[model samples]
Target: MAKDGRGAPVGRRVMLGVLGLGVLGAATGSYVQNSYDNLLAQISSRDPTGVTGLLPGGGGFRFYSVSESIPHRSDQDYKLTVDGLVDRPGSYSLADLHAMPSTRLVRDVQCVTGWRVPHYAWTGVKLSDLLDKAGVQPGAKALRFTCFDGVYTESLTLDQARRPDMLAAYRMDDKPVTAAHGGPVRLYAAPMYFYKSAKWLSGITVTDHVEPGYWEHYGYDVDAWVGKSNGRDDDPTS
Candidate 1:
């Protein structure tokens, strides 16, 4: 139901298969960009890979997506809907988000799967500000984030969602976020595992209770704090 990166409305693409990163790059004609789109485009244009985990960073870190093909969106056609259990439901365009006060977080990005990318920088609007702007209603105890990718979803309790470090991010590493990296915007949950920060972010629904998200439903902890929730003793990221 959302538009692709080229501004054309498209259905959610499913992950069908995965090819080796080396073969993917060679067949696709260039080294995979650190972003999501180039790699996904190569996959979509050729074969499908259920490549949810990607080590495009020369093994320094990993980039991942659950689906084989990624959804794309241009800022001009991108829209974010904040609704469900709010007194003042709102829909925001990319420009509207850019005008808001932004917060920058330089925190370690940890994946529950055991890789870490330290001191990555993210820039975006505070989720708390957006909730306040929408006038969140009483009994809304959790926030559910739905991504344009169609298969991924994540949640946070009201307290976690309001953390000053949590952001609805549009920029990463001092540059505009690319499609491969979950732009025009994505969520950044600094204290939680990387999966808590959903990419291709599209909808925010306020709910009366916390519903376990995509990975949580599959055995990952719903409250995915870096070292605490997943039973690993890694140092905390925040």
Candidate 2:
């Protein structure tokens, strides 16, 4: 077993056969900070075949970061840019986001890999609020999300992006999101599969058409509805 920063056992790393390499053994604790560090190493060293999704979260939900290593941005340096086909394009600092009215929602998180965390509470500004502030231009059909992580991207149709359930999330389960868990801020598309909620979210661009996201480019569905998009019939989380 690999121990965490506080010397708690983080269970074991599951270096299974090719189809399941880099998965993690179930470990639970609120104090095991280094578990994410070990799991992040495993992710960078293997394929993205849903292996990282198995890494345990001390707070009940699992953690997954697809980058070669987790990236960090201090709150002082972090900014979210909203642009493309918009009239009032603008950049917002972390403090700017915090000043916005907050919306909190309790929704289920369904990962494409067959894991579901029901009733996860997320707190953030509504995506529609930002889009409205930017004054979306005519002919904008979709919204694309780019991450500070450098590799992850996700898109949603204009209608989907404006839904009340969609948010630019800054907190999860009532706590400020940590770096290992896509901190500073992330997107939360409550009705879509978890992947649609891009982590380390940095940009929101209005697009003329639906662009495939990172996983979608790798054959996952671009419109990742909870149970309908990816060939799985699990119950819808929204």
Candidate 3:
């Protein structure tokens, strides 16, 4: 959810309706549901149409866009860059990222607003591998993530970024990430709130200190550990 610029539907009221609708749709006819979902998926850009988000959701993911009508990036045009406070800066195409060592994890995704998707399969390259290859320089304290969606941003301490669970994810449910899912690449912040896992991920920059993300500007916790911050007391996500 963009505190302002983020187009995602982070508002609790909107998300409540979204979650409610999907469950309601499940009781309807299968053919009717699938047809509606297919039509919406084809037309969706950053997310399936806002209306479709109310009809049926796949994999328990709640759907909403960062903003209005964000043009989806094609697989051939996607690139992810790693730079800032590093000895070696690099830009990687989707193919280049895919060629690197990959890791797969099945982790539950928890949204700060109170919804959870359990045992979701995510596959990607570890951010630690990229940090090591980039030769993190002395005094670097954190990593900031920027998204192609043009509004949402996220951050982690260097120590947090180096956690084995952090990833630059490219696949989900054993399928190549689709635009509706924030694809060809996105940040998979396994142990944090789902919002910390920025969608349409494009840049990773090492920095001297942690930078507040978009949502942070509007009072959401900067350190969004699931069930830990923001008045939520629940299970540890990891």
Candidate 4:
């Protein structure tokens, strides 16, 4: 069984600060409250436990990042790069992605760290669809995802990337994805553990083989299907 190095002890001061901000947000409900949400995001960027993630984030989903901070990208500045083994190499802005065809899915989001958020709504362009548009090369056998945070990366086999359930999701919770939730765009691998779905998605580079993601390098399974990998016997999310 693979055990992750995360879940380290966070500070009590951080929790107390969050709680205080939550009270302030409730009491004020002004710009300060909005700022509180942003402050929580800053705190959660360094939080491996996802405890702060459940507080300000929209869904029950918890936030975790390998980077020192969560990145925020706007429509004008955010771009998803498609390159590597593809015939067409280019970047797509948030507007370009929003104009493309979108598929909606409602599925249980199960995390490897013993958390479950059921029947969450996800909407985005299918990964296979994006690959087709980019014209994957004959030599391509895998996909490597790089995030805007500059630390996290994930990979999938070509067959797995082509699954109908795999998506480059731009929307969740029936609204635009917030930065804490992986923001303007993120990967949604419905059949796998939530960690397999990389957040703050920035680049999708087609490759000839799969490279282990950050967690995978730390003894997590590269193909982290729910209830299958990590030696857990929980209900299958797929």
Candidate 5:
């Protein structure tokens, strides 16, 4: 198995495939990344055939239950609230997010299930910027992210939440996010599996200890690093 940039061991199957293709004169790193991203686009553009089809490249990404999906709302009526352990607890509209300094990144999207989509482009605000604006208190040790779907929720340790790659994403594929793809806003945790990037994100509550998210309580690892925690032995996206 080859180690990813973060030194996590990649699955032997993935490493073998990649190495075999290298013998065919294919450039390994960037080329594989671009191919994976293209595959994700193709998968997302079509109706899902099943769990396998809903994810990129057949069935490598992890899938979690929503418990329930919330009703979709238009951008005009959408609101995101930042509350909990902060000096400034306030609400932000879609316009508010658009008005902030925006960032764009193209990085690998890995899942615990074994699939990966590399070089996927995401555009949004740095999560740290929002935390800074909200004035996170010294006591804040975790961030709970609640989705509009009501059933989906996630939490990150303070250090993880502040990572430069984390984003409150508004756009994907160079366009505004569609409802099927997590919509008007979503949490993008670049170093973790796609599940950590909760869809239809709505609320952010800063707290003092780690809170196991919906999936975490149901056998998923709370600190879900791509290869390190899930028992799947995949490569780290970072």
Candidate 6:
């Protein structure tokens, strides 16, 4: 009788031990499934169309498709020409540009596709200063910018072009830009996404009205504000 009673309690203990193991297995399975789902969600998520590609440092960088790539020329070969509508249509070499007063700014670089890198340091001449030197005409309501990438072009109103935030950048992060990064010269429009900052930039033609650029013609908003334009609901980096 004592042996029977002991067997009954042992049997109950074994059952409880098996039940605990089952519960633990179920919990572990649920945790693994949830973790897998979360990883899949992150992997499957797509960036918005026209968004800039990621850079090496875990920072977001944007690329503008230009018509043609202009090889980086030395100071002797580099010539920035101003033609279109100006009194003193002239050409400037790299040396001439370097001689001019320089301005340095630190601003967030926003991309239309939904990425923003803050505090990118840029050093260059002000667009307004250049326009002033070129002596833009009274009829000039817009400015068309051309790049070495023969396919890409951008246009901005005179008011927009003259904004303090607009820059004809020569350096990024305290160093000269490289060919892979639109070097020698590039437009830097801090208020807009990096695409608006045309790479391999060459020409600035002042005109009477706005002209849609490459991306603009393809349905991108002309005025690509950080959070307001491009059909994005993201917050502004600025």
lDDT of 4 by residue, 170-200 (tens): 9997899889999889999999999999999
**Candidate 6: stretches off by over 4 Å:** 1-57, 62-70, 234-238
> Candidate 2 — what's its lDDT?
0.83
Q: Which structure among the candidates has the greatest lDDT?
A: 4
Q: Candidate 6 at 81: error in angstroms?
A: 1.4
What tens digits encode model 3's per-residue C-alpha lDDT throughout 12-122?
Answer: 778899889888776675567557545655555346445545544432587656755554888899989999999999998999888999999998888886556778899
CA-RMSD of model 2: 12.8
Per-residue CA lDDT of candidate 1, range 8-127, in tens? 333333222234554676676432343454444455445445353342432234668997787899999989999999999889999999999999989888888766676789999999
- Residue 17, candidate 4: how far off, in angstroms? 34
TM-score of each: 0.75, 0.75, 0.75, 0.75, 0.74, 0.72
TM-score for candidate 6: 0.72
Q: Lowest summed lDDT over 10 consecutive residues: which window, candidate 6? A: 50-59
- Residues 44-88, candidate 6, lDDT per residue (tens digit)? 345454222332223446454454554565546666777788888
Clashes of 6: 8
* lDDT score for candidate 1 against the true structure: 0.84
Local distance difference test, each candidate: 0.84, 0.83, 0.85, 0.87, 0.82, 0.76
The better-scoring model by lDDT among 3 and 5 is 3
Which regions of candidate 5 are displaced past 4 Å? 1-70
Name model 2 segments beyond 4 Å from true: 1-59
Tens-place lDDT digits, model 5, residues 1-238? 7755755456777999888977865446556655775766666556455554654355333444564544586999888899999999999998999999998989888866556766788999988999999999988899999989878889999899899889999998789987777879989998887889998889999999998888898899989887788787677776
Each prediction's Cα RMSD?
15.7, 12.8, 13.1, 14.1, 12.5, 12.9
Task: Flag the better candidate by lDDT, 2 or 3.
Answer: 3
